[model samples]
Target: MTPIRIRIGRGGRGRLSARILVSQLAILALTGVIGFALFAFAQRSALDRTYEERAVAIAKTTAADPQIRRAMQDGGGAVVQAVAERIRQSSGASYVVVIDLHGVRHSHPMPQLVGSPVAEPIVARDGQPHVGTDQGATGRSANGRVPLYGPTGELVGEVSVGIPERDVLGELWHELLTFAVYAAIATALGAAAAFLLARRLKRTTFGLELEEIAGLLQDREAMLHGIREGVLAFAPDGRISVVNDEARRLIGLGTALGSTLDEVLPDGRLRRALDGTLTGTDISVLTDEHCLVVNRMPVTLHGRALGAVVTVRDRTELVGLLRELDSVRGLTDALRAQQHEFTNRMHTLAGLLDIGAYDDAYDLAVESAGAGQALTEFVRGRIGNPLMVGLVVAKTTVAAERGVWVELADDSALGADPPQLRLLLTIVGNLLDNAIDAAGDGPPPADGRTVRLALTEDERGTTVRVADTGPGIPPGARESIFEDGWSTRPDRGTARRGLGLALVHRLVSRHGGTITVSEGPGAVFTVRLPAPAVRPKNRFAEALPVGGDRR
Candidate 1:
């Protein structure tokens, strides 16, 4: 099937380049016409002036001749006429009329006009050469008059020479033709230059018309600002080039264009994720206040590196919901384990009653009830906060289901609920979960797989410690384990792993606290959180410098 292509703003209209070229050509043509008119007028005036100067020189020379002067002083007869005619022919002038002080013509081109009175008064009567335009029998011409001086140096008559206007017109026409050719050449070159300039402009604009470029700009603005995700673009020199509203809101940035990443964001996992130093897809970073999923991709055009773009998505609420879901899943697993255990005990009791061993069945039921009661009472007594107590109990049940033993240390104690309970829970919950996973990863130890947690609170602050009995973390990977997306185990699926320790570290740092890890046959993670009243004024700022130092 043949397909038809549709073009917008391009039908029944010239392309931008063609339009520009045509407009430039039109301007050049009009300019050339106007320029030629001005050139012709100026050339005519210049030619008039040049012919006048030539006429004056010719008249002065003719008047100075001994023969014409003598003839004019001898009362001017046939001798004067002959001499004037001879000088006129030699000087290439239209006519040379010798006139006396009475303005009577002694010589004329027509013999009949000889010895006739002139129409105008003699202009050179004062013995000064005079030049001007004259309308004579031969039509208009450039005329110059000079007083004739006799041998005694007295003015006798005047020699008037006229150069025909036709000569000036002929030269003007010749020069005009040459100018026209040059003008045409200049116009052609200008048109060619305009065409090349238009092509260059077209290439720079990607052949898009002005209207299309405006439309694209509008569309880009709408899309960039309307999307839910935050968008940030950088130049090749690592300066921020483009940032949208959502980006500013999500990252808490304000008028941050043209700044480098370091100038805007503090040195931490978030900055590293955005700057491509910590490269990954959908990398999760927990800031002091937000949980962000960042993705960075380098941009290139025509094999030229055009810096990079990083997209940020606010995942704070999503992560919170996911955490709740994980908590629910843990509770559900605990319930299933308890149900299975209850079923086995019920079966044992049923079998015992049928075999007439009621005493054994009674003992088994009491032992199961007592063990569960003792663990709960132990956790409730040590943890003063209900949420922390619940978390510990649930994690213990889940750990038991996975064949790992969870033990609360005997010295663990919290007098009352802390001001930052949520942060404390995040810190303790993640550590316990990680410890359980580590403890349950391999074969049970001789003493059985055990994960121990210790909590302490005083006037200073709160402290949490979790230790696992499994293959310990290597010394080289101790610090890396706290990095986002750096997991010791293989990835399970799309579910993001390895954020637990990272989140814990971030919270601890934000609260002006410290977290450390030690290896005592296994990985032991410890965290110390400062009291709210004693927390630093700019905890995040202080923590950034620490992170920068570490990096």
Candidate 2:
């Protein structure tokens, strides 16, 4: 498998808080300015419309007065001026003028300007009325004009009332100031909201800049995949959160990073452990040919359970190495025992020779040679495979050390493939060890405290029978004997005492093998390992890909 590489990014990066604060404040202020401007424009339009409409109403009402129309028909005089001035003053109009249909003003704000033609001819056009801004005798004003007619329906005069542009602007400016105050208050409130928002964002980001956050994400990806051990984490609701490449291969999962834990593990025990419903340390589990030791821990923050993280350690190869080590250790001890025994006899022969007993020394030497030859023949005649032979020899000496006798009654030539050889060693080694323990102390201490092994292999595969003469298994206790953490009897201060039988069961079931026991004068266990074709797996296998993609 290819290794993941790490990457470095720029250090001492700036914080994003200041930038965000400035941005938000600017946006809110801009919105306020635009909003106020639109308000002012629309208000000005409405106010001007109101001003024009008011002037038109006043001018039309004054023109419709019977006294004003009668005076206009009598030609310009003081009565006309008096009525026009009174109407203009009371109506808050800038100027109220009476004009003849010929466009000559009959009465005006300035009497001097009376009897003069109006400035805009549209206002004086025959039988026409107009509302607009125009330069009057005094100044530019929004003017509204209305024509008066005699009872005969003939146009005789026109009334013009003006609202000065200066007055209209003054009123608009005052209203705009009030509106601006309200807009300012609203803008201030928005700015306050933006300030709080920026602070919350800064806290959530933990003062990291955008680039720094991106860099951290990249580093997380590299770190998760770079480790050799498997790591898998789940969310509070059981959905898979993080899964590394090694985890996928160890769990035999296929592209399961986002799936729920149950979907990938398919083991209820494992799920319970992940969700904190079950908890244990260094729990052993079997998956295919691999033996995994899982350690699970809850992910918590301030006493709240977030989820769990499970670390998987592959112990398959380690176990095989341990078995090989046991074989080696056993052979070493056997050789040491033989060396000690032979040395004692040689010394006895030497002393006898020193004492001039040639006959006795000769016999002793012959006996020693015979004993060594018998030991060699015994190993070669029963077990042909060197590794298994070493194991049996070691077990024999070990059992002897504990005052129990161990024997390999029969063993066929185990010329099997490497896969079958590993299976053979694991199953037989565990059973033999268990048998020796069950046999307890040897002969005379107990009537028949002996452990025996029988093995035979054919096209259908190998069968093994182990019988021990110690206290045999009790009735109805075989059912759960192979269950994990279920020991026949508890060892002092030890909880996982009977993992051997459990492991044996796993290997047997994995390889389509059958194992059964019977209670008698002694306990006898018979196991039948299926042919190599039934289950073949090389002990030395390479790592799989990120997912379970065989391709």
Q: Which candidate is the best by lDDT?
A: 1
Report the lDDT of model 1 for residue 227: 97
> Looking at candidate 1, what is the lDDT of residue 345?
87
Scored by TM-score, the top model is 1
lDDT of 1 by residue, 34-67 (tens): 9999999999999998998899898888887788
lDDT of 2 by residue, 367-411 (tens): 877864676578767666766675566677766755677767755
Q: What is the lDDT of residue 161 in candidate 2?
A: 91
> Poorest 10 consecutive residues of model 1 by lDDT?
542-551
Report per-prediction Cα RMSD to one decimal.
Answer: 6.7, 8.6
The parts of candidate 2 lying over 4 Å away from their true place are 1-27, 50-91, 95-225, 229-264, 267-319, 338-425, 437-447, 450-551
- Model 2 worst lDDT run, 10 consecutive residues: 542-551
Error of 1 at 501 (Å): 3.0
